[model samples]
Target chain A: MNLKKPLTAETISLDLKGDSKDAILAEMVDLLVASGHIRDREAVLKAVLEREKRMSTGMQNGIAIPHGKTDSVDCLVAALGIKRGGVDFGALDGQPSNIFVMTVSPDSRTGPHIQFLAEISRPLNDAAVRAKLLAATSPDEVLHLLIG
Target chain B: MSGPAELHPLVQFVFQLGVLIVLTRVGGYWLRRWFRLPGVLGELIVGMLIGPYALGRFAWPGLGHLFGLAPGGGAVTPELHAVATFASIVLLFLSGLETDLSAFLRYSVVGTVVGIGGVVFSFYLGAGCAIWFGLASGWLDPTALFLGAIATATSVGISARILSERRKMASPEGVTILAAAVFDDVLGIIVLAIVVGMVRAAGDGQGIAWADILLIAGKAFGFWIGATAIGLLLARRFSRILKYFQSPEAIAALALGCALLLAGLSEMVGLAMIIGAYIMGLSLSRTDLVQVIQKEVEGLHNVLVPVFFATMGMMVDFGAVQAVLKVGVVYSLLAVASKVLGCGLPALFCGFNRHGAVRVGVGMLPRGEVALIVAGIGLTSGAIGQDVFGIAILMTLVTTLLGPMLLAGSFENPASGLRKPEDAAKTESKEIVLSFPSPDMADFMRARIVRAFRQEEFYVYRLAPDTPTYHIRKDEMFFTLECEGDTVVLRVTAQYEALARLVVVEEMLALRSMLHMAQENVNIETMEHELVAGLFSDDGEDGP
Candidate 1:
């Protein structure tokens, strides 16, 4: 599944403040809310976290996709946070996860949500893209590097 | 990458791990497919093949460097050895977790009887063999006692893995074997303490003090009982303390930290690190955190256990093997016979039939890590000379190899119902839901919905994506991606759900952390407060 909507620069942050996965996830979920991407912060945070326990979304190459599908957001919503000194996301590779792609969707939409997840995952598979995303100075650079 | 001197410590560790994992997999597959032997046997062989005793002996350029040796690698470095030791600790920890405490308690009577029989018989028989067949007379008593103690040890990891692979973990014979093995470990350690203490006493020109002997044994048991009681009492509070943090690494770190702490403490009290780690596992075995600890520690175990096994393989000195070859055969045979007769008769008397008793006896034959440690201690302490130490090592290697063969054969005799069908169909299903439920309604409904499912029949997880895709267990039903969309599709397939409930608890903690971040003032100490008390209590009060 490929994501139809483009991730805007407004919802992306280069400086994530949390030292742990939960704290980072909270920061990311807060970004999505502050950016008007999702409405109920607690509900979305709970849903994203509930999904987290099933398994970590931390992928190889220091990327973590912490996502949830709930009615807290009307349509597809996504946010990104980057911490220079990575937080332990309990990745299989046992490396700290630096790049976080947070997504929240309406509970009714399965196809587009799956597509969005796949789309985020696909670009991350490229080492060059991953490196570029990590090295990018701002969210604009990250968006261009990821979605370009 | 060019030289061992230039490679980063992290890089060296990664390379070593990569080599070990690849070789263990390939070698283990070949052994299982062709010889029908345990994978561990193959790992040991592969380890020897690539170790300093063999390929590295020839000064294979890159191989030596990769294993953390000089260009022409001589021995594994202290750093690498430390890694193996860490692996050993993790291995013992995992063995402890896999232990069924209730079953251990249930079979304690028979297990203790069988264990004592095996220990006494093996000790006396092995000591008699060592003393009678040996030319030296002056140091006979201590040497024989040390050798006897070495024989009494049973490798819980080796036997447990073999039984698990055979799918006999739940069988009566397996339970008895495990119980006996546990008892054997405690008994073996005590025997070692007495022998070592006696040797030290004689070296100092003093007779063995009865008071000192009693004290040492008391310390061993006291440490175990005390640690278990204290650890269990504190485990729930520790779990609650951990819930305050959202890092998945926190739980594993805490668990491993505790294991190491106890291991160090045990060593400080003159007990083995393995004993300490095992005790730590037992202490947490009944707690809410056992599942959580198991979930986080599995990854560490996979990496470290192989290192321990492979390093053990590397310890086999070919010269020792050659020198002791003739005596080794006799000692090995004596070792096996002693365990079989010693452990077997007790099992038979304890309501097990002839075949079950034989199986139990065969199971105890592998003197893996424990034997090596005992031999090493004896050699270093001068209780046994190099040649005798060589003989002990040879005896350990032979017994280790012979164990799986006899164990497999005993299982194949078909007289007992212990052997489960290898290809039994599993009834569990893994459900993947691609639904477009309202994001608002999804969170409100999840806890309520999942709570309605009987906890006994269905184990559910809200966040389970932390597991590697390959490791995504089949039996677990996990909910993910709560988003609003156009349609909902549910797909169900059979899989394992062993980690199902553990995942839910982990998710609840994660959510708790999130809530703490959202509300800076609320002090949520447990899942009940944030999950059940805060959210679920007012479920119907809000509608999307």
Candidate 2:
């Protein structure tokens, strides 16, 4: 349960140019497609969009984690991006957000998902942890800060 | 701070909560079974039985320890109260979220009529009873009158539950009832404010004058508008910030912040925080990220809302009610009669006819959390006597149990004569696009539609707002707009239609008017089919 997962240094591209959420989401999806993790971009996109109808995973600290689990993946999958200026994510705090960390897993793996969520998220609640993670340039560095 | 810290605070708190949860469930469940009221009512009874006022007051040693009872001023804290208030706001916002605004607007006319008429009539009846019975009880007319005035409200939660049980919530009548209940709540709260003002003036030992009452009424109305104006502006600006950050943490913080500010302002203005919460909900209702905000806010209710309802129950004096069960029974009946006759009469004259009248009476019958809230406020103030408190509780109890049974019993036999529309959702599929009929509204929507699309095949015929027949006892704006490729037809009330057509003519005559501005390629016309017009345009972007 306490296995230290590898933290790959990820660059979250935040495009503040678009006023619409769909536009922002499309940019993130394109990044995932380019990364070669997602198969049928449209299908995955629809699945993620549908899951959004269930509940938003967006938390505090200018972040949006729009995630939906599917049976297509056996391993953990995530996409990170940063909106340069920030776009309205419909957050309760009424702040524009630029950071996104979407996670996808097999529907059967609720335990790992919830556990990881609480672990990774504990830091997001603190401003200092976010600054460290967002500023980390390498995956190893990100992991060191997250798991240390 | 003084409690045993041997165990972890988390463990102790959990234990306290566990006891409360179990006690609340048992008492609430049993009360629901016997009293047939909302589970909250039972929870309240049990809380009263266990709270400082009852079991703690009596100090039943073993049971009190097991149930986690404590003496007055020793158990609950301001922090808990704040938590409860927050939960209440979340619950209310959820309630507002559950309301289907589009569906509600369809019968806005009916809802407004029944709501206002029922409240007005019910209020007077309660006041009259307070005067008559109150005078007999040696109270002055004005105080008694205010007391009765406080009774005219129908808490929407109970009525919504009953409607859902009967499966009539989606039915036209049910929709009307639900909408009416929503407005009734808004109106009732305002009335409560007025009464509070009157009470305060009297408490200050000032002479209760008609002018004083009028001033209070004026202030209450003005106060609501003032709060809403400021809240709406702040909320809109805050909503803009959500665009800058999509992070869950930031989003949640923004929502909590706005909720707190609005809630604080509402309290400062002497209004319920829920009112402020509701106003905030309304202001943000139309945003794109509404669903997003909703997802996050749901977490708030899971914990705090139950606490709020539990707190309401905790405020009850169960033993006292039991001691005066006879008076409780009697007062409960009086409360019912006052509500029915008072609300029913106006509904009948307002075109409900007999079944309509009875429907109005039944719809207004279910006493809700509002009654409990009133009693709580009164008891805390100590301005009301034990008898009055007992009567208030009795009123809440009787009304709670009576409404569902009577409505169900009446509507059971379809022929039993309730204008109760068949089922809650019983509606023949009819799609109607509602537009308030006025040249201003018509022209406004028309302009927006024209700007959104420059379709050459656009035609808008003139239709005035809907003015139902004089004898119909209805007041609302209704019109039909038809849009063909280039030609549009509108069907409106003749009088308003004529005015609208003349206005359109005047606009067309002016060079700056839409007619002159209409590009040869752009069909700026009102169409005959409103449904088609709506399907193709942007929300708020394409107007009428």
Judging by DockQ against the true structure, name the best candidate.
1
List the global CA lDDT of all models.
0.66, 0.54
TM-score of 2: 0.53
Docking class of 1: incorrect
After best superposition, candidate 1 residue B532: deviation in angstroms?
31
Write one digit per residue (lDDT tens) for candidate 2, span B320-438.
Answer: 55665665565566667765665566555543556646655676787756665555455555445445565676677678778777766645644312244342122321222324345
**Poorly placed runs, candidate 1 (over 4 Å):** A1-148, B1-18, B62-74, B135-146, B156-172, B185-211, B246-248, B372-393, B411-413, B416-544
TM-score of chain A of each: 0.91, 0.71
User: Which one wins on lDDT?
Assistant: 1
lDDT of 1: 0.66
Q: Write the per-residue lDDT of candidate 2 for residues A1-148, one digit (tens) a residue.
A: 3425412444234332455567766666666564555656676667577655444545567877665556565455555666666778776577877676665555554324433343454556568877876676665665666567
